[model samples]
Target: MKLKLIAPYLTLIFAFLIISCSSDSSNETPVDPKAANNKSLGTAARDFLSAEAFTGLHVEIAYVNGFKPSATTINNLRNFFSARLNKPDGITITETVVPATTVGSLSREEYVKIEKDNRTVFNAGDELAVWIFFADQNSESDEGNSRILGTAYLNTSCIIFEKTLKDFSNRIGGANLTLLESITTQHEFGHLFGLVNLGTAMVTPHEDEQPDDAGVDKLNKHCNQEDCLMYFQTVGNAVGGVMNSLPTFDEFCLADLQANGGK
Candidate 1:
């Protein structure tokens, strides 16, 4: 199947900046009521993606023309997350059309500048910005690999391929594009919101010559285990290439939010 050919999702890379010297209380300002609530971890053993009231997370999706993503793509992604998350305030998804833009050979500086310049459509911590670059998602030789289908370190946002949003028959279709896009956003945003891995070092699969241990299988979710967004093969759990069909929340993610006072 075409879905199987799509490489499984990879963990996001986060380079945290430590502000060594600062007595600024505002910098450590308490999280907003909504964020505080999202950080709350309930004891219910129900799905991590429990239905709840809308928290009003506004998502702004921007596309660099030549990549050609559809208008309905963003909507599909929003609906998927909405069904799983209880954010009653209502989440808003908006599409920003940037004409005369080419996705070819887009650089980090170009992307970072575009994001900073479009502050009217985006807010640093509150908004989820989706940028679709004109690149091949399946290309392993991409020098700027981080520019597509992954999280950006400059501002902590999501970027994907325009090909991912196509309706090609006999190929990956439906919500698969949106699902992959959202997966990148969800995982990266999890880190920005204070979710840390249980271990200090980022987990890698079988770096040594030892046999692969079933216990170290980070792709599969198991009972009495921590299913974090940083899982090595998080995308493998989903059906087809559609990430919405997979489980969105787990104890580890919930607990991380709670520890950071997101609930």
Candidate 2:
């Protein structure tokens, strides 16, 4: 089915600036928390790609009661990670079922707190933990026809607007629901890997120029290739002119990952 969208559930990357933590006792900041999993997006690209720092990758899937993703969606994500990451130890994932939420929209700070309260993984020892929250609510940042489907907000954190994506995909008889979920999830992870100059530097300058929005994030973040997985548009993940399955990252995005130590 062709997905007709009024406002496409677009992927958002906040190139969030690394927040400076407060001083400790002797005017020295603590090293652990500063470089912890809560840092800005894409800052830990090498840690995720190469096994130099973190040999094992653990993914924490936390979702609201009614919004847990299907097994197919999770498996697609695993396959996507296996193709790029050099985690010989392996990439593991687990699901956490949280209570259903009532909020109509989620805020950035609210998302951070959700992870902080329930996240059990972190950048510790030899494993780097990633937390993906499947939120039942849309983002408070959504304006009119511009809704955010998934976001790469922090280095190790991502939020998927399950409600928005579900509606966008098949609410009015659109594309396959599973494909949309897989694509949105993988796209968010792309930002975590620093695609398009977010954290992973480009081997060639292929950043897509967006003139529609004036925000800092609307510039220098997405791929110039419209059909690439990291493309700024929602149709980037569609196949054969439809949203049928997840699309692999374009060559340039793949090159960026390799240069940054990915497989």
Score each candidate by Cα lDDT: 0.36, 0.71
Alpha-carbon runs more than 4 Å astray in model 2: 1-35, 213-218, 235-241
lDDT of 1 at 92: 70
RMSD of 1: 11.8
Task: Estimate TM-scores for all models.
Answer: 0.49, 0.83
Q: Which candidate is the best by TM-score?
A: 2
TM-score of 1: 0.49
Per-residue C-alpha lDDT of model 2 across residues 1-263, encoded as one tens digit per residue: 01112353444532211100110112212224435875766788888899899898999999988788989999988988888999999988978876666566877667666777777777768998998999888877666655567777777877888887776566444567678788778877887888768779999989876454344433547778866877755443341134465677888998999999998
Task: Tell me how candidate 2 scores on lDDT.
Answer: 0.71
How far residue 102's Cα lies from its native spot in candidate 2, in Å, is 2.8
Q: How do the residues 122-149 of candidate 1 rate in per-residue lDDT, one tens digit apiece?
A: 3235333223333333222233322123
